[model samples]
Structures are given as C-alpha cells and as structure tokens.
Target: MKSSPIGGDEHPRPLIREVVVINKQGIHARPAALFVKTATKFRADIGIEKEGEVVNGKSIIGLLMLAAGEGTKLTLTAQGQDAEKALAELSKLFEDKFSED
Candidate 1:
C-alpha cells in the first residue's frame, strides 16, 4: 500500500513541536485568543495536544480547554504547505510567553 501524506495533502509529514507554557498565567482567555488569531493566519491545519488530547489550534475554546498552566508541556502539529512556518510561529508564541510577561 502506498503511504498517504499527512492531512490528505502531498506534504510528507505534519510538522510537530513540543512547547512549554512560559507565561505566568498560562493559556487563559487572552492567550487563547491570541493563539487562535495567530493559528488562523496560516493555511496549514493546526492542532494543539496536551497529554495526548488534541484540539483544533484555531479554536479559542479548544486552546482554553487545555488548562495549560505555566511550565506545562504541549505538542503542536501542523500539516500543509506552510506547516513548517506555522509551527515556527506557534512555537514562538509559547517561547515568548504569549507576551503576557
């Protein structure tokens, strides 16, 4: 059998990265909204995973549901032509502490 590309596309594999919540407040409403905003800007399909539970990266509610507190590690996945770029930007948000200081 032929192997299929991720997200039903020609992309070899979905870009995956592990990020830790560095913000003091974690992914609360503001951060969730920002995350969703950023994720929506990319054409790639994005998903945020916490302990195996994955949620749509474009959904604010989904992000908020993770309850990803400070220091919590999460996995981010993206599949599409811009998968690499998407993951880069998304992971930057985590590293920047969502700009919440």
Candidate 2:
C-alpha cells in the first residue's frame, strides 16, 4: 500500500520485500526495538506481515504480537520518498539476523 505524500511534487509508491527470520533468538525485544528504530529514520511508512497479519513497523508492541521465531517469513512494505533505502536497510537486518546469534 502507498503512503501519503511528504514534500511537494511527491507521490507515494509501494515497495515490498520478503525475508525470513534467521536469528537464533528470533525477533525478541532487542531486535524488534532495532527494527522500530530503523523504521523511524525513514520518511516512508512501514508495515510488516506474517501469515497475512500486518502490523505497524514502528510499534514495538505490534511487532511482538507476531511472535516471529526463527524461520518465520515476513513481508516488509514501505511507501514514500525514502522507501527504497528503508527497504534495503530493513532487508539487510533480516538477512543478517539483526546481528544476533
């Protein structure tokens, strides 16, 4: 889904990426917090989905509800001026297992 425009002459464009949780601990407190922190740095709106349940990427509580353990697949969506960059960083986080063991 597209997000509302930010600056002048800007239009929302949807961007989506899929990743699997490879971290041994999954997306626990620290990783979720890191996800939210990274999401907030972008101008795009972010959402994460697992098994069709979508949640706000910026909310720690929302992410916790998913209980995304290792091997859980998630869809990451972003829309706005910085969507490309945001997706790249977020995807890297998942690919890197949030830097956890």
* Best candidate, TM-score: 2
**What are the C-alpha RMSDs, in order, of all predicted structures?**
4.9, 4.0
TM-score of 2: 0.89
Q: What is the TM-score of each candidate against the true structure?
A: 0.87, 0.89
Please give, for residues 23-93, the per-residue lDDT of candidate 1 as tens digits.
99999999999999999998889999999899999998898889999989999999977778899998999
lDDT of 2 by residue, 1-101 (tens): 44446554255668999999999999999999999999999978999999999999999999999999999999999987888899999999998889888
Q: Which pairs of residues have clashing backbones in candidate 1? A: none
Structure candidate 2, residue pairs in collision: none
Looking at candidate 1, what is the lDDT of residue 24? 95
lDDT of 2: 0.91
Residue-level lDDT for 46 in candidate 1: 97
Candidate 1 accuracy as TM-score: 0.87
Best by lDDT: 2
Residue 99 miss distance in model 1 (angstroms): 1.0
